[model samples]
Target: MLNVALFDKTAKEWREENKDLKGNMRDYASLNELLVLANMESFNAILIEKGLEQKERMIELRKLARNQMLSLEKLNKGNLKQLEDKKK
Candidate 1:
């Protein structure tokens, strides 16, 4: 099972660690969210396709990447929530 609390803490730490990120990585939260969505879609794509051995290996790679993206997104969600809470 995935740990939401851990993700949140990780996000907060990421924010602190990259407070001054610029250019493409500036919108950390938004970027992470996009990554999460893309990862999920790709993961679904892998399972939806009934292909050969090489294709299966490629799909597995995609799933691995998706998992990583989701973890980052969870962290981003936690960080954003913490910021919102602080503003309250």
Candidate 2:
């Protein structure tokens, strides 16, 4: 039985180590999704915990998520600017 807490802790640690993240700290969904991305390091790390692989691939899905978030932020900002422009 894979204890979700272990991964949860790992994800929390990653978040804490990466100070750039802002907002709610409890990101269970993100962590679980990261583990699902076998191409990423998070899956490798989790697998290594069980000696499932000789070499773990650190995929780091969080980085991708962050990139997406940044893109969304930019898009929203651009929209807001357009709204302001329209108002003027």
CA-only RMSD, every prediction: 13.0, 9.2
Please, what's the RMSD in Å of model 2?
9.2
Instruction: Go through the candidates in order and give each one's C-alpha lDDT.
Output: 0.53, 0.49
Write model 2 residue lDDT over 10-54, tens digit each, in one string: 555667776787753445345434344333445546667766634
Overall local distance difference test of candidate 1:
0.53
Please report, as a residue range, the 10-residue window in candidate 2 with the lowest summed lDDT: 1-10
TM-score of 2: 0.37
Worst 10 residues of 1 by lDDT: 1-10
Clashes of each: 0, 5
On TM-score, the leading prediction is: 1
**Model 2: runs farther than 4 Å from truth?**
1-58
Work out the TM-score per prediction: 0.37, 0.37
Model 1: per-residue Cα lDDT over 1-88, one tens digit each: 0112113334445666677865332244465545554554565456556553654645564556557776877887999999999999
Model 1 residue runs over 4 Å out of place are: 1-53
